[model samples]
Target: MKEQIRCAVLGLGRLGYWHAENLATRVKGATLVYVADPFEKQAEKVARELNIGKSTKNPNEVFEDPTIDAVIIATPTSTHAEMIQLAAKHKKHIFVEKPLTHDLQEAVQVIQTIKENNIFCQVGFMRRFDSAYMEAHNRIQAGDIGTPLYFKGVSRDPGSPPAEFIKNSGGIFLDMSIHDYDISRYLLGSEVTSISAHGNILFHSFMEPYHDVDQAIAYLTFDSGAAADIEASRNAFYGYDIRGEVIGSEGSIQIGSLRHHDIQILTKSGSTHDIVPAFPERFKNAYLNEIEHYIDCLRNNEKPSVDEMDGKIALEIALSAKKSFETGRKVLLSNPTLSLD
Candidate 1:
């Protein structure tokens, strides 16, 4: 039998729990050997639930463990760069959830460490592996959507996160719109040249204190002369709505909708279908595929599709949008890699 790479998942939060569970049972050629969280009880709880052999509240335990070959970092945004650099120093491959680092310089530092250590790293832009988005990307690449000119994306949550989370989330652009930034780049196959952002606090007045917004729209100009219109919202009360489309000279393609399932109920009230409650359920398959790809790369000694550079670019676009929102102007990327901070 082939050996499986011993893996540890840092942070036993909701996303980390899911990451560990996926690596534990779903992703072949990978083994979940340890799990960690700052809260000892929380770490113990999920470690027991996952049937993982080792669990610790101290992140250092996972980083120092010689048996572990890699780590999945699903920690809070602030801790990402630290965890990643530590894992790289340990000679472990890494798979990090997105928005790489809240600071661009830190992302550059992390990427440097990964390179110096000769380790593999994959960022969690799971949409790239989603069947629907993949189809659009493939078709666009194949010229099915000839000469792509415009891109549109929508992501609205059925509910809002805690006020505390928002305080530390680096605002809507990095927290929410970052996903769209990456998706736009993926579908358009281009980098954003300039960005202008408009934001308002339609609801969620709590954001006022932090200068964040409940809704935002960003306009992006790409190097390919293509433009993208992105829409983001914190409340979709109906459900977790996520969709994207690409418009080109020949035709266009669109994805997602309010409908959650095929079966629509018909009655005097009118036809209605369920709505996907949240992101986890909506992108479940993509999550699985991404983790599987990580394991495959580990086993084959191949580079994962989305690496640190991808994470850095996506982050730069997001930071630029944030800068735009703050300044009410179009921020130019004088250097694609230039840090807005």
Candidate 2:
């Protein structure tokens, strides 16, 4: 029998909690060894529920444990680099959530350390594991769309995040549109050569102190003569509608439909309507499927669907978009092989 992979998850917040729970209940050949969070109460609660082997406020305990083979970092954006460095020092495989780090320089450092350690590192670009998105990607690559020319992606939520979260969100483009950046690259199969963007705090004026923009639209031109338009908003009244369309020379492919066949029509003086809730319902399977893929990769000793380079490239595009937004001009992405400094 194969040995079980011992895993520790850092952070017990919303997303982290989900990671712990899913690993505990769904992942085969994986054991939940430890959980860490600054909030002791939250950590204790999850520890008891999942029957985790250990719980603590300091993540170092998990890092120091020789038995723990891997660490899943779901911590805040700022702490990712430090945690990744520590994990590498311990010779533990790492799976970190997106954006890598808040600053580009720090992101570069993190990648370098991982390379030096020669440990596997995966980034949480979960959407790539989703079935719907995978279908779209395969179709585009198969030339079903015949030399993709343009792509459009929309990611909108029903409401803005809390004021505190907005303060640390690194604006709408970095925090939210980063996903679209990855998806754009996936569908277009080209590096983003240049980007231009327009953003404003139109919906969430109260978040002005944080310089948070609630709405942003970015245009990306790829090296293959393909282009992509990404629109992101935090105040879509209908629901959390995320959809994409790939337009090529032959035809177009649209993924995700708001209307399901289960919708019932009621005839009351010729009136009918459909029910639409928030994002928690729309993308639930995508979230679960992502965790499953991570666990499978760990068990098989195979690389994850998304790796550190994908995360860095996504962050680079996002940072470029922010620069374009601020300067009112297009910003070009430097070659990945070239040193930015």
Candidate 3:
């Protein structure tokens, strides 16, 4: 019989709970032993519901436990670097949610900590695990699409988050479009050379105080001569719509659909179908796939497909985009003066 990787999940918010549920029940070769969050009741409730062995209000306990082999840090973006550094100090393998840190210096420090500890660290860019996106990537790699030339991506949330979240979310690029940035690099197989970005507080006035926006867009020029346009919005009253397309010299590959099912009702007045209402529902399988992959990598002593370096690069691109938006100029990734803080 194969050994199981004992695990713990920190944070019990929406995404955190989902990851904990997957680690508890779905992921093979994984045993969820502990759960932690600042809210004692929330942590205890999640532990009880998931049948985890222990629950704690302090995350330090999770890092201190020698029995745990890995931890999924689903805590707030602001706390990622500290949690990651602590976990690395404990020599525990880590799976952290996206955008390692809003600040590039902190990202660099987190990368250094991971390297110094020689621990396996995987970032949660789950789009790479999605079936359609994976197919597109495979086709691009197989040369079925020849040399990619252009990319277009759309990401929309059904509604805006509270003002508090926006204030610390590092704005739209880091909180939302960072996914698009990561997937663009993954599918285009190139580094972003420069980016021009623009944003506005179209509907969410609450975002204005934070200098954040409800709608944003960016144009990316890649080293491979491929260009990309990404649009992100929190006012997708229609639904949680996400779609992407890549045009290559030979042909083009398209990914995603607005509809949840193939069938749509036809009527004299109109036609309608179910739409993806939220990210968790849309990327459920990808979330599970990422955790399973993390466990598999741990058991096999293999490196994760998406590592801290990828996280760092993605954060750099996101910061570049934000800087471009703020200054109303195209920002080069090579520019050394860039800083989010």
Candidate 4:
């Protein structure tokens, strides 16, 4: 028989609420025990909607709850490290949404604390769980793609965030393109060795306060002597266009397209198809799969497939890209090799 894991959802914002609802209604072998957020009303609303027994405005209370076995942290970027450290100290397992910590040193410290406390920590890198990306990963590991040599990735949002939000988002590389960094590594099975990047404030000038650009392109060199080219944009009015392809010695694998539906209309004008306008819609299944994987790992006493170390390494790449953009020279990475064990 599987043990039921008692869980708490931290941060009642968009992604936080999504996790809470899933834990309450979708996930099995897990019970939603509590919901916490800085906003008491939002927490109460989400808790009520999920029919959870408890709701609080304070996240620390969730960590202090002996009945809670694990916590899903959907908190703001600024609070991630503190929450992670606290959860580890309280001997609770954790599943935190990505860019583990805005500060690299903080990220390293959080991982060390989890290790010292023997707590299981899962970092959310949802793309790794996406079926298309999973198929690509499996094929590369199986040698079907044969000696993967190069990669190309594109991640564009339908619109930009408010200026106030961007100001605290740690810049475009850390805030957004970090996913591309992870996707590149997940596909190539190698670490980034160096990076060079260029940016343009092609659309939103409000990002100036944070030194964030609306559009940027970066080229990454990997440990296996492979390279990846990635471009990210805060505004892609055509929809949330995200796609990637890996070119290997033998063949290649491509994933994603502008998708809302499969059908396309054709006529004298041309072919027309709907485009997915948001990340949530496009990667909904992936997010669910990742959260479920975390709960299953707790039940089975197994380590997460993608853990804190994966998050740290991806952040390192994003940091390097940022420095490269600032200096106009390739920034060599000094990241310690990430261990999957």
The estimated TM-scores of all candidates read 0.97, 0.94, 0.97, 0.97
lDDT of each: 0.89, 0.84, 0.92, 0.89
lDDT of 3 by residue, 1-341 (tens): 34899999998898899999999989989999999999999999999898989999999998888998899999899999999999999999999998788788998888888989999999999999999999999999999989999999999999998887787789999999999999998999988999999999889887776889899999999887899999999999989999999999999999999997778998999988999889988999999999999999999999999988888889999999999999999998763223323
Q: Quick one: RMSD of model 2? A: 1.9
Best by lDDT: 3
lDDT of 2 by residue, 1-341 (tens): 33588899999887798889888888777898999999988888999999997999999999999999889999988789999999999998898888777788888888888889888888888778767788999998888979999989998877898997778778888888999899888888888999999988777888888877888999999988999999999988776778889899999989766643346576867755453466556656676787667667777878777888888888888988999998999998767424534
Residue pairs whose backbone atoms clash in candidate 1: none
Query: Cα lDDT of model 4 overall?
Result: 0.89
Which segments of model 3 are wrong by more than 4 Å? 335-341
lDDT of 1 by residue, 191-309 (tens): 89999999898888888998889899999999999999888899788889999989988999997766767688999989878988899888899999999999888888889998888
| Runs off by more than 4 Å, candidate 2 | 259-264, 269-276, 337-341
- For candidate 4, the TM-score is 0.97
Error of 1 at 328 (Å): 0.7
What lDDT is reached at residue 277 by model 2?
A: 62
Compared with the true structure, what per-residue lDDT tens digits does model 4 show for residues 1-341? Answer: 45899999898877887888788999989999999988899988888888999999988888889989999998888889999999999999999998899988899899899999998999889999999999999999999978999999999998898887787788889888898899898899888889999998988987777788999999999888999999999889889999999999999999897868988999999989999989889998998899899999999999999889888888888888999999999998854466422
The weakest ten consecutive residues by lDDT in model 4 span 332-341
